[model samples]
Target: MSGMHAATHRRSGDPQPVPPSAGRPNARTTVTRLLCVGAHVDPAFANAVVKECIGEVADTDRFVAPSYGYDVLPVLGHALIARNRRRYRRTAILISPFVPVLLSFLGMTATIIGIALWLWATWAAVFLERLITLHTLVAHLVVPAPEGGRHGFDGRIPDHAALTQIECDRINREQDGSSGLVYYSGYRPFVGAGTWQTSSAFPILLNRANDGILPPMDDRRSPGRAEVAPFTTAEIMGYIQRRLTAVLQAEEWEGQRIEELEIARRWYRTAIGRVRPVSPKDAPLPTEQGVEHYDAAREYLCVRVGSWDQEVVASVFVNLDVRGRTLYTETHRYELRPIKAAYHEVDRLPTAISPSDVRLVAAKAVVQMAGEAIGAAVTICTFPYHLLLRALSRNRPVSPRDQNEFGAEFPARRADVLDYGARRSVREIGQAPGAHHFFQDMDVKKYGDIVQKRVSELVIDFLEERNLDTGEYRARQATILNQGIIQTGSGRIVNTGRLAVGENASA
Candidate 1:
């Protein structure tokens, strides 16, 4: 992740560990496959598409799994499983009695009575320990330390094999069959777990000055006609990559030295409705091999921008399709919001754990601990039931036929199987808005515009090189480049080459 600054120069190579997927939460029932998160987590109700595009991320897969914000899973797991060791040990001892009763029918009544007594005591003890641990840690981790004005909370999480195993298992079970490898290479969705933002599309007709629009496929019947064209679509794409990378990596301004600006080929998975009429019966292909040959709808030149120390990430996916005499190009952007305010509270914590701070935290946590104690009991008691459910439940399979139906695969069942859109933002889960500066938002917009504009210019260049008339393209390009966000009573109107008037309107 620290090496992100070089992403632009080393575009072809892996820059960081492939991001890890937070194990999908367990299925609620045999029929239901996903958790219904409230508006707090995912305000947009994004189609929950799979985030792991390259299939399972192995430990050896080198690429940064940039976390948009704080992930409570690791912290909570470490705190409850590793720190609360004594309590779990006692719980095991208590549950041991039930094992004997179930296995051997000897002294069943006596064993049942003994089990009941031990269970109650163990449950009470675990509840108390868990409650106190949660409260105390919250206080110590949140409260201001004695020495430093800034909180002393440590971000470093020590390596623990068990924690890693738990996280991997949880993520795999929930993310089963959501891999891009299972679908057409061009249908790979955005891999980052973030929110969709603004987008832009530019379609240019490739016709020379004197010659009117020419049907690209008109020569199919006349094999004698030479395939004379200005330039192949791939050549234009190569030009854009080279030119865009140069522009981004240029040292022309301050606060513009980007840490992560990755430009590479990625399969751009669009909604089922947006997917072009590609064959559904064809076997899926690996995206890296050569998805460019697939429909333009699925392949894209993804430009990733990681700013504010990777706290804010914006991805611009550019797709270029040359069909007949028309060059169809579109750019879709996605943004990952900042970490939650609560995680930032660590800034207010003391530099070191002090006796006085500990005592104070313990005192403040007492009331909250009481309530959490009850929750702990329930969780422990229902462990068997939940375990059983997980054992019996199967992760639904994604149907290839469903891809042909517009919005058909988007229903609950299919979405649960394939949609991996982010449900909750990091800020919502942490119970606080991101502590982002106004400048950060401005920077995000600036970067997106810079890359998008460059892309448009390169397309024009491609046409120019072929001696094609650039009049229409230039006119549309000027309008598209003159994009502005106008605020209205209803909401914000984004004006581009094509005016999108709705409050929710995006390119």
Candidate 2:
């Protein structure tokens, strides 16, 4: 995780001095999907790991599906440690009985140690209770049963949200002391509603990104939502289109049916409108004024490739791309999620809690007696218990599953785990819906007026690529550069301007 955080911070501007994990720029080499029980390798780092895994996939002809849930190892380790200490109790219990026999040989030392072990056991009982209380409290926090996101409509950012800059800067700072920008806009997309599998093409995305097989960085400083740099919605969609084009282009495909085609409004799914009031505590302050309710549903554009295409999907969610310092430093973040089936495999109980407390106690008692009565021969019993602990964890593989089921029902969980990306999108997708209803049903080919002059070239470049005539394209570009919206579709692209001025998600 530190490696993932440091690698990106080096790319952007981060004040925090996070030590990069071993391998530095070669983070791809050190990728472990789930490094430990609870610690997850951010997709940024896991992408490289996936690339290495993909070669194995081809050889095995099996999909490495990601899995998610509470890791059982941490508490399991705690249990094991607690169990190991019982050996001391076993020593006291077995030796005390032989006091009449051993007093001739060892005297008071043996008696004193026995007394100490007994005292320790009583104290350990209290310690064990404390550990249980701690475990129970932490469980309530992690278990979605009593949380905000159980039904997937919790609206909280997914745990893996740390894969991006906003995640690192915002969340990490939130951890230290400072407060992040407050949002008041109620621009909820799902409305406490469950969404479908989001990105089916995650495996492919990770495979490529890890292999450094990504779209060449042609442009980094894209204009964003701000007062001076008022970027229009079309421009944002254009970037998404461009990124998608690059992803589709890099894929190794056998089809010749559609090699290249202008991505139009039909390829996107979007919803933007006014809703109810959402306080700043819930909604961040809107950058643009006249936007009243934070509860209003905001912009959401799910770019769709050809229907049912099992391809990786990516969201290059940008906060600001200013050339600050160098014009202004912009935060360019990307989240790539693959679709997998294992996300549906819900882990109901904590598997680590399987070790029996009574059994552990009993085993320790037997070991001490056997050791005293039979000397080193007690190794035979201790060896088996060591193997048992290993068996408990080893029996449950942490790596991706071998035989994966694709297109599982979406759980709408915000948790980032194996197959989560796909689960979200799958739940939302079944039959492809009508023509892409972008933020305002804007016609991409119609070439609307550009709103940002600094980004005019970008808009023009975007328009030129789409299927647009020279006359219509030039006229729209001129109008748009001056901050005007052209009547491109049956209805003009209306900027409800309801969005708050900030870039952070709602509280």
Instruction: List TM-score per model, in order.
Output: 0.53, 0.22
lDDT of 1 by residue, 1-507 (tens): 121112222111111221123122111110010111111123222111111211233221211122222332223323333333444645554454455356446577766766565555444554455444444344323333334433212222223333354454443332322222212222335544356666667677776654556554654434333333556556777788888888777746757476666776543332223223232223253333224432333656778776665556667778777776777777787766554443343334444556776566555545544444455456668989999888766554555664655644544243222322323322223222332676766777777777777777777776776667788877876766675654668887655334556774534
On residues 315-386, what C-alpha lDDT tens digit does candidate 2 reach at each position?
222111212211111111112222232221222334233456445544554444444444322543476898
Give the best candidate by TM-score: 1
Question: Looking at model 2, which ten-residue stretch has the lowest summed lDDT?
Answer: 200-209
**Which stretches of candidate 2 lie above 4 Å from their native place?**
1-114, 117-281, 288-315, 319-357, 361-461, 465-507
Q: Which regions of candidate 1 are displaced past 4 Å? A: 1-157, 163-188, 210-228, 251-259, 268-297, 374-435, 484-507
lDDT of 2: 0.28
Report residue 471 deviation for candidate 2 (angstroms): 18
lDDT at 377, model 1: 58
